[model samples]
Structures are given as structure tokens and as C-alpha cells.
Target: MDTHIYTADDLDAAAKDIVEGKLVSFPTETVYGLGADATNEDAVKKVYAAKGRPSDNPLIVHVDSEEMVEEYAMPLSDEAKSLIKTFWPGPLTIIFNLKDNVLSKTVTGGLDTAAFRNPNNDLTLSLIKKAGVPIVGPSANTSGKPSPTIAMHVYHDLKGKIAGILDDGECQFGVESTVLDMSTDQPAILRPGAISAEQIQEVIHKPVLDERVHVADAQVPKAPGMKYKHYAPSAQVYIVDSPKDFEEAAKWAAEQDDKVGVMATDAVLNNLHFSNNVESFSLGSDVLSASHSLFAGLRHFDNESDVKSILAQGFSNDGIGEAYMNRLNKSAGQKHFNK
Candidate 1:
């Protein structure tokens, strides 16, 4: 039960462990992933156990190159090919009909479809190449908690629970990858991330459907971050859209019997009034910075222990703001206050 942190220099050792079916946490451009050999059912089950993730929640398989996709999956549609041509080696995961015997059944949660992505990180690619097998992984944290953006974040949540961690530093994108389900007639985005739906639509020359746009309570989700109340901190989180509303919400929470915290951008932080009862954290000046700091901020406040509740300013779904809003909504569990 000893968990060690590995640097770039230790990648060979890490890859060796991974190939031998040891659970290793590695960094990707989007976030740190708790990886296991995709072809090994026991190794894949260890990933679910490490994260306390649901057995039914599918994992995303990461490959080193586009050609490897064909080895584990088959019957890729024209649309899936186009997306791979455009977004592979990036933060987009495309769902395909999984091939039999090549991948562990645990990876697909016993389903016929599997999600695939080729991360743009050199270390990750090198690890995959060295391992000589596809790696199926999920965010390196306990299920329902904020996703890990830095290697230490992985250690904080998963230390001793896994094999080893590759400390490649903070991830470029704080959010998880965009999960596109090509198994459907029309391509549907099961989750939003750095790659926006509009961007995908422009690439495909077809409208990309977002599952979040509609309310389908009865249907089960096909990807991670879909059916679960994810990215939550220990504190109760609420989103306030307007600056005026945020001020009111922050003040009200601070004055309550419980200790409170406020998460805001520089623009909104300067305008809000603070009391001894409330502690404030800056999400950043803009949406991009907010995206980078959102999860960390949530985790930071949680570490304080005294902060019982938090009020975060709602982000607009513009540009990378889409992913920012998605994480915030999940963290807050869709609780919002408007003026």
C-alpha cells in the first residue's frame, strides 16, 4: 500500500508497471488519469476500486496513436473518422463499438461501446508506447469529488490506493475531455470539455447534439460525469449569476451560523463586501483562468475545514467557458440563485 510519486525520468519504470497490470496515475492534457491496462480485467477493476467509481460508469481508453484505435475498436463510422482526423491527440473522446477480447469488459461497464482518446501530452504518449497496450483510465480522484488537475491533487486523493503517480505538474485544461458518442445515429456529446459542441459541429459540418440540452430523467447516461453528482467539494456550493446577486448571496451566507466562503473572479471579487465570517478565493480574472483554478479552488476551500458553505459566481458558456460552467454546475449540483 505504498504510493510513490514518479517524475518524467521515471516514466520507463511507470510504463513497465502499467504493462504488467499495475494501476498508475498519469497526467494528460485535460487532467490526471488513474490508468490500468485496458486489456486486463483485474487491472481495470482496480481502477474502479481506487476511485470508488461506480461499476456501471464506463472508462475512457487512451491510445498512443490513431492506428491503435482500430486494434481495440472496429466499425468506426465516417463521422468518427473525421473527428479523429481533426481532434485526435487532443481533449476529445469518441465512442465506438468495442471489439471483443481486445479490451477488458470492466472498461465498458459490460456495455458494447468504448470511449477512446489520444492525449496530447508527450509523457502520456510515451507511457502508452512503452506499455505496449491501451490504457483505460478515469479522473484520478474518488468518484463525486472534484477532478484532479495537478499530480499532487492525485496524490492527495489517491495516495496509497494506487501504484504510482507521474508528477507532470498542472494540467492545461482543468476539465475532463469532451465525450462524443458516435454509437448514435446523430453524434451526441455526452459531456462538455475544452472542445465545445460548436467547434465539433464546425469540424463535422453537422449539428452536434448535447445531451445536457434536453431533460431526459428516465434515460441512463453513457459516459462519465453524466449520471453522477460529480466534482463536489465537502461544502455546500451555490451558483449566483449576477454580480448583484452574488453580493447578496455571499453576504447572506457569511452572516449565517456556519462559516462560509466565496469564489469569484477579480472583476467580481473587487466589488463584493467581505466580513470576518467569510473567506474568499479568486477563481481568476476571466473564464480561462477560472477554468484552470475552479477545481483547485473548490479543493482549497474544502481543506480549510472551517468553511462550511460556498457561493460561486456562475460562468457564461462562451468559448472555454462552456467547460467551466459544466464543472461548476456539477459542483453546485445545479443549485443557483438569480437576481
Candidate 2:
């Protein structure tokens, strides 16, 4: 398959293809999304096949406006409404009860809830409007791999597998949206992104943290993406909290007699010592900056064959740190080295 770059004018054509059950890769403020018509089961399945994503992992539906969101999701609570007023057209995803007959079972992974977001980017919003359909869009990459933040990242992972890509440049957030579960009595964060829990609590007047891990029954799930090991790299990843612990762990990792790589902020990099064969890359100091560089850095390390293991520094569990930690944790998987 040939990957075509779409300009603003090509958005209509892209939307047309999406309506016909074709997968169209487009940009969002957070990352590029591989979009399919959410109401079309076949179209949503195409997304799963194109990116090699598991059917059990759920997709987030993108709407052009709040009214569009209301059509698919149940009436929003005052808290959900407040959040939308402040953060819609941005990197915020709200999980709510699905309206009857709105989304296909494939879109919600046969669950009663759905994840929805109204993206701020012009190209994506226009495509949503033109398509005139709620789009089930996940990050445009193979499941369990790094999420694509730029159009090329999409091409790199999906070039031969998908149809076309809309290259609007690098994503602003460089990660997925902050996902809040508003369907329940207590609002909880399903996924963290640019919007922090503190910011959401400030508006809702309730405490919120990361949602507890729930084992989804294979038959049904609130969202499919929640059930899988995601954002993994080829090399094993380990996370340590403080600079001292990271140094010690790096020493230990080096002593393993394997070529290791270190992923941390510039400050942490200055404090660690590794074998001359080991390479170090900075994910920036703050969580937001780290989130931006996380996937690209992993991809860089993954491409280098000599780098056998990756040691990462733990991020603060605040603001964007919540999202950063989620991705980091998933990437590290069983390789996490807590101290």
C-alpha cells in the first residue's frame, strides 16, 4: 500500500474514504489517530487489523463538537460538562455511558461505556465534521508499540499496512489524551495525558487519581485498550525513582554484562555512570516534556541493536506525570526496578 500525505484540501477525500470503511490516519493535538467510522463494525475491525491491535483493546471515538459527543454518549453530569467547557478541543477523553444504538459493539469492545474526545486540531476536526460520523481512533501504530505522535511515526509503523496519512507535523502533547471515567458515581482517571487529575478535581470539586486496575473479562470490557500490555519497546525497560537509585540500578544493569541504555532527564543523566558501550538519552525534566519524548526516545533506543536494556527514571505522579507514569509503567512491564 502506498502512503499518501494529505493536505487540508485532501481532508474531504480522506473523510470520504473513512465513511466507506477505509482507515485514514489523521492528526490530533495529542497524536495522530488511525480513524474508522465508529458505527461501522467492519470499519472498526479494519483499524484493529491495520495496526495489529487486539480486538479486546477499546478505541476512543473522536467528535467534532460537544453536540456530536452528546449524540453518542449519555447526558453528561455537571462535572463532565464543566470539564468539556474547559478542555474540549484539547487532549481530554471522557468515558461515559454509551447511548443506545449509537456506537457499534466493536467500537466499545462490547461494553456499555465509550471513550469520547473532541480534538483541537483543525485537520482532524474538519475530517470529523466532513465524515459526519463518530470516528473510532486509536494512536496510529501497532498495538504494544510506541504511540505515533507525528505523521512519519504513523508511516513508519503503518506504511504498508494502511491507506493514507495526513501529515500535519509533530503532535503537541506527544501522547494520548487524559482519559477520565465519568460514567460512575466517582470520577476516576482511566488514562492520564496533558490534563492533570488536579485540574479535573478543581473543576469537579472531587478527588481523582489513577483508576484501579480492573481485570476485564475477555467477553466484554469498558474499553479494549485497558486490557493489554501497551507501549512496549524491543529492549526491556526499568524505572527507578530517585537519581541515586537510578545510578545504582544502572551500575547493576551494566554489571549484568549486557549493553544497556538509560532514559532519563538531562539532570539524571549527569548523575549516572554506565559502561562506555551504553548510550543515554534525555526525556526532558518535567513530565510534559518527558511525555513528548518518551515514545521517540524508546524508538531511538529500540533501533539500536547494541542497546540491550533500558533504565528509566520514575516521574512525579502529578499533572502530566500521571500519563507519563502510565506509559512508562506499561513499557517497563515486568522489568520495573522500584527502589
Candidate 3:
């Protein structure tokens, strides 16, 4: 199948394609999303096939505005309204009770709740508004792979499998949106994203629950990136949780006969012992930059012909570091040495 790349100038055509039940990959502030009309069952199914994503893993719906929620979602609670007021049109997703037969069955995975986000990207919002329906979108990449943060990353994973791609360059946030479940009395964070739990608590003045943040062995994922072994590269990944462990792991990888790669902060990279068999990448100094470059760095190492395996230095799970550590843990698939 032929997949065309669209731009901001071609919003009308892209919107038309989506309304016609065709899949389209577009950029959001968080990551590129493989989008389909959320109300159309056939279109939503195409998204699953394109990403090779499991039908059981629910998709998030992107709407143009908060007012659009009345059409696609069930009545919101007071707490849910507060959250939407605080974080809509940003890197935040909220799971609300699904209205009866309003959305495609494939979108909610037959559950009574659906994830919704009012993205900050102008092009994406314009396309959704033009399509006149909420678009259910997951990250534009093959499932269990690193989520695409750029247009080319989308093309690399889903070129011929989809309809078209809107190239808005690299995404602002290198990770997926923070997903919150507001169905229960106490809100729980299902997925960590650019927006930290602390930040969410600050907005609502209520303690936000983040079980997945502390519990590594949580079996069932309430949201994407939780229960699955996801965001992995082609090569094997191992996480070193401390500077001591990182140094030891790097040295150990260098001694191995197979080619190895190291993903670390500048300080960690500076401390590494370089050799012909090892390639090291600086994933940025601070947590935010680390979050922004994490996927790209993973993809970089995966594409390097000489790199056979990867050793990544883990970050502290504080503030945005929570999101960073979450992705690294999944990318490493819990192959970690904690010190």
C-alpha cells in the first residue's frame, strides 16, 4: 500500500482522509499518534492493524476542545472537570466513563471507560475539528517498540501500513501523555508522561495516586506502558540504577566480545572508559532533556550497525524523572542491576 506524507498546508485533505475512515499519523506535543476516527469501528480497527497493537490495549481519544467531551464521553465528575480545566490541551490524558454507543468498541476495548486528551498541537486539533469526530490515537510505532517522537520515526515503523502522515517535525515531549483514571473516588495515574504526579497534585490540591511509580511488579497495566514489556529497541537493553552500577556495567560491557552501546547522562558518559567495541551517547544532563532525547537515543543505538547491545544509566524517579525512569525501565524490560 502507498502511504503519503502530509503537512500543515494539507490539513483539509488529511482531515478528509480521516473522516473517510482512513488512518493518519500526526504529531502531538507528546508524540506522533496513529489516528483514526474514534466513532468509526472500521477506522479504529485499522489503527490496531497498522501498529500491530493488541486489541485489548485501549486507545486514547484526541478532541479539539473540552466542549467536545460532551459528545464522546459520559458525564464528568467534579474532580474530572477540575482536571480538564487544569490540564486540557496539554500533555495529559484522563479516563472517563464512556457514553453508551458513542464511540467505536475498538477504542475502549469494550470497557465502559475511554481515555481522552485535548492535545496542544495546532495541526492535530485542526485535523480533529475538521474531521468532526474524536480521533482515537496511539503512538505511531509498532507495538512494544519505542514510541515515535518525530515524523520520520512514524514513517520508519508504519510507512506503507497506514494512509498518510502529517510531518510537524519532532515532538516537544519525547514521551506519551500522562494518563489519569478519574472514574474512581481517588484519581490514579495510569501512565507517567511529561506532566509529573507532583504537578497534577499541585493543580487539583488532592494527593494523586501513582502505584506504578513505586511498584515495579504491578502485573496488569491500567494504562499504556504499564504492564507490557514496551519501548524496547532491536538490541538488548540493561539498566544500571546507580553511578557505581553504571560504571561497572559499562566496564563489563566493554570486556564482552560483542559490540556494546551506552546510554547515559553527560556526567556518566564522561566517566566511561572508551574502547573500539563500545559506543556511548549522552542522553542529556537534566531529567527534561533526558525525557526529550530518550527515544531518539534508543533508536540511534538500535540503528548503529556496530552496536549489538545497550547499557543504560537509570534516573531518579522524582518529578519528571518519574516518567524518564518509567520509559527506561520498560526499554530495558526490567533487566536491571540496582545498587
**Candidate topping lDDT:** 1
lDDT of each candidate versus the true structure: 0.85, 0.82, 0.83
Q: How much does each candidate deviate from the true structure in C-alpha RMSD?
A: 1.9, 2.2, 2.4
| TM-scores for the candidates | 0.95, 0.92, 0.94
* 245-296 per-residue lDDT for model 2 (tens digits): 8857866876776778788888888766667767888988766788898888
Please tell me which model should have the higher TM-score, number 1 or number 2.
Answer: 1
User: What ranking emerges by TM-score with the best candidate at the front?
Assistant: 1, 3, 2
Candidate 3 off by > 4 Å: 213-222
lDDT sort, best first: 1, 3, 2
**Number of clashes in model 3?**
0
In model 2, pairs of residues that clash are 56-224, 57-224, 57-225, 58-224, 58-225
Q: Write model 3 residue lDDT over 179-279, tens digit each, in one string.
A: 98887778888888877787788877899987564324523334666555789998888887777787668668767899888888888888767677888
For candidate 3, the per-residue lDDT at 235 reads 88
